[model samples]
Target: MERTGRMETITYDCIREAAARLKGAAHRTPVMTSRTLNKQSGREIYLKCEQFQRGGAFKFRGAYNTISRMTEEEKQRGVLAYSSGNHAQGVALAARLSGVPAVICIPTDAPPVKLAATRETYGAEVLTFDRLTTDREAFGRQVAEERGLTIVPPFDHPHIIAGAGTVALELLEEVPDLDAVITPIGGGGLLSGTSIAAHGWNPKIRVFGAEPKLAADTYRSLQEGKRVSIDPPSTVADGLRATTPGVLTFPILQSHVENVVLVTEEEIEDAIRFALLRLKTVIEPSAAVALAAVRKGALPRDCRKVGVILSGGNIDPSLLAQLWEREATKI
Candidate 1:
């Protein structure tokens, strides 16, 4: 695997290899269907339930795939990463399983449950940064260079993108005739990977992304024909708050993704409530973006079958309660 610098060229073969690497290690999460949802959306909807993934997110696939391929010396030296929540736990758990030490740099405001899971349950050394005040990427690089630790970024890396693609690979394999696929976008890894996999399976398969209107950098980037950066996002969907699309992931998106649908914070919360009350599942606001798009008729009326990747279910209970309580006042 040669790199052209910090990025490597990813191909469908890379994704297939990632799927092979994750065969026994990662769970083959279930694909769920809701009759009520299908009736409401007027489409056959298949939900890829990644909330049941080992780290409670799809991020574990990329983390484990990347860590498992590290050289002996690199493994001995360990790894470093910066993530708000899900990716932190993904890297920590993967490093732990590989018998490699890890240091994760996280935002001070990341969800308490996710933060505690990474540090306490996974037993990784945790570092905190003020997201508003610190350049976390630069800090991670300095720490990695000083300690000789490999940096496993949340997204951007070819391996991470390839691993994330396996989610769509599994979905398309299960439902071969999906008219389109929609996934929540943060740094664009999931959507990028999904685009590759869906097209590889069937070039006609439409790939779309769900983004918070508050942090729709990828959406704007796609419209502008270049990557666009937005101000630090204050969306309730913490995992979808990436300010910009990944350089590596952006190109793939430009070529492969059909388009991105933007949903408001209220829509995100409504989808979350729907998942909890109607689907009997708990999905975080980030994951609910896809569902919001579906329920709100973001897809074309002709599109009959849609596959949605429920990215994760790691929301804080208190936050969820507060959001629901605030919504109840309006009703």
Candidate 2:
């Protein structure tokens, strides 16, 4: 299993080193489970609860890993990044801790909670753009050049992928016998990293991704065996709305990921509600997709031991209330 080309830097060794770096810094987020969910799915579901992570998402792992490894001059020059929400907060918090200034470009429609945390809690300079009309990468690069700031990509970078892989490493170390693992796919960072971690730990462990149908670029990319772009996704699961898979991530996903399961908007919302009611957890829509796949029987019946990454829980209160109201009427 000599991986030659693209993802050489996102190896198990890289992830291990990242885990070492993040040992005392990152929270070893709890692995949660519900008997009710297990009975309904007929599987032992271990939810890797990353909503409890710093910045309220697993993005902190990659952000810190990338920032901490920078040269003293690079850190002083600071970093620029663009993210819809979670990654912005991650970079903001990480850069603050590392004494490096961070400038984050976020969409105007990003969750208010996320934007506030990035600016107020972490003290990052915030820039806003129309998500549908503006190209975030180009804008971020231009800003970085103007300020001599290094661009901290949300998911495409090697350090980001390696850092994210540590989630799966922690999961396997605790559970040790997971038959399959599923995570939400945005730009493919978490899933690609989890693929490396799962296979590296035990090649027999299966890896899959759960995605919102409204934002199914990763789903289509896997089907066509090439990257595909979609219009800016309009979905409640805002965190999973990446238009295309990353160049680095697509190759890792193509080589390692088994398949991606697409869940409808309704399914995603239902999972969010179920988490609040049944599991006594408040998971955001992006995190709920993984649970939705299990509840909808997206995996094989024989996948008796399953691991699901509950990616985040940074929903705005107003949005949560709206979702509850909408779901209540349907019931």
Candidate 3:
């Protein structure tokens, strides 16, 4: 696919069209405020708690919106997708809801909790690949061809981008005067979509994206002024492990996003702990990227009213306990 260049020109009409398509399918996830967070950060924090979203992540919003628009023939043919975690659950649940059979291609090394959830909960067929040697996109395409399944890409589709945009729609509705908004980026679906919605509502609203430094594809892409691929992503944040940003999303991000900040594994761990201890939320490492950005001063301190999208809360309990133990040892 050819890269989209300078996406700031993306009009509100496109976003409105996406909003209309996503109506009733996507949840209007709530904007939650924490007085404790407010006191500590010294900023009024509005958390777009997408942890409460269907399939436990905001990915479902885009998945459903995209699949729901598919033709009846397409539905009968079913859908195929590749994801390590959140997007797997999103595609699975979306296909289930749309009454279509779904196949998810996942890394063999994917977290047991996420893989099990994708298969058992959503009733999707799971195909595992050796992360060390297998090419997921190629494998996914093969599966789609063999099974006559329409590929619902994790990001890159216009409908998917629009669907993802609804998160910011709901957030802006609840907190109209947000000084800035921060979200985690993988393939740039959520970041691009949210940036479009945020800028549509208020052009001055600062839009930032956070990434794990271990797998900072989007950050590198932004710096290079083009999409870049990370051949071997090594990050605890499974949801942010996409090798490259989508062509469509990259252009949108290049124009609208204020910055793409990278956070180290340690900072990510600290942010996860902060979410668990202070916010009382079990956020996945991917979701912790935004909070980590805030703690690292990646976001502007002058922004009094800030909105952070807690992308998901599907951490494995065993891993959670282990993370807590590690934190305890450091103290």
Candidate 4:
């Protein structure tokens, strides 16, 4: 693990201000209750359904807040970003809403459904590169320089962290006495945001981060007492493929997050299937990490009130069919 001086740490006040800035721009996604989850887990569960958010993920809140806070000059130059799917859609839609042109750098291996949605629905320019050979961050920087586009990072930016904190803000508003809160971590945006909001609301509430075992950089980082990178991450959770934790999110997580738990790919798939079958909601693999943690006994058994952030719902129909068939065969 190594420390990078380039990263900016986000603060509780910063997140609060960012939430205020995103007041009308981002959706205050609902806190859904499930009797099935309660019975199965033996604890009251409050699911923060970010799947209902605009662009079908909590990434929208950060994107909109970050883009909206840009200078007029920055907006005039347009915006550029790199993402596998959710963040790409978030940045594209946010740019569109702000009347700014957007260019999204995507890996050639990105899901076809997500790529299509980003281009057709948001009208963003899609630039594809080989996932194995190309460095997306470098590509994004090159595009930004060439096109005069301001880079609105997916999770590393201060404004992005702040915007993401709003999810916890809304969640605690509905479930004030939550014993513990769990959220999936990618580049640490959502987890950091959740930490800020939960601790800010009530310091007694514990916040935990759930990560896929194959791409568990955050979990390793916390253990090593510094940031770590997991190159060529192998996992079904495409959205949590970030190799390095964000500079802005790491400090907040270190200060506020109580633990980081790892979930296997199989566990993630099972959680996704459980959400679809029992909750009747579509959740991406990354979003299901929190639920996977619970199902695997990563959370404390005595936690009376638990909150899990169900971060997104977008899934290719083919993948959905495959998952359903797999579940059926197992049954």
Instruction: Estimate candidate 3's alpha-carbon lDDT, on a 0 to 1 scale.
Output: 0.86
3 or 4, greater by TM-score: 4
lDDT by residue for model 3 (1-331), tens: 1224643344555667766776777677777777877887788888898888889999898898889888999999999999888889999999998899999999987888889999999999999998779888899999999889999998888777887888888888888999999999988989988998999899999999999998989989889987888886888888888888997889889899989889998899888898888878788999999988877766677988999999998887787899999988988
Clashing pairs in 4: none
lDDT of each: 0.93, 0.93, 0.86, 0.88
TM-score for each predicted model, relative to the true structure: 0.97, 0.97, 0.93, 0.95
Global lDDT of model 1: 0.93
- Superposing every Cα of model 4 onto the true structure, what RMSD results? 2.7
The TM-score of candidate 1 is 0.97
Candidate 2, residues 20-47, lDDT tens digits: the string is 9999989999998899999999899999
- Better structure of 1 and 4 per TM-score: 1
User: What tens-digit string does per-residue lDDT give for candidate 1 at 85-185?
Assistant: 99999999999999999999999999999999999999999999988878889999999999999999998998999899999999988999999999999
* Candidate 3: worst-modelled 10 consecutive residues by lDDT: 1-10
- TM-score of candidate 4 on Cα atoms, chains taken together: 0.95
**Stretches > 4 Å off in candidate 2:** 1-8
User: How many Å off is the CA of 98 in candidate 4?
Assistant: 0.8
Give the Å shift of residue 125 in candidate 3: 0.6
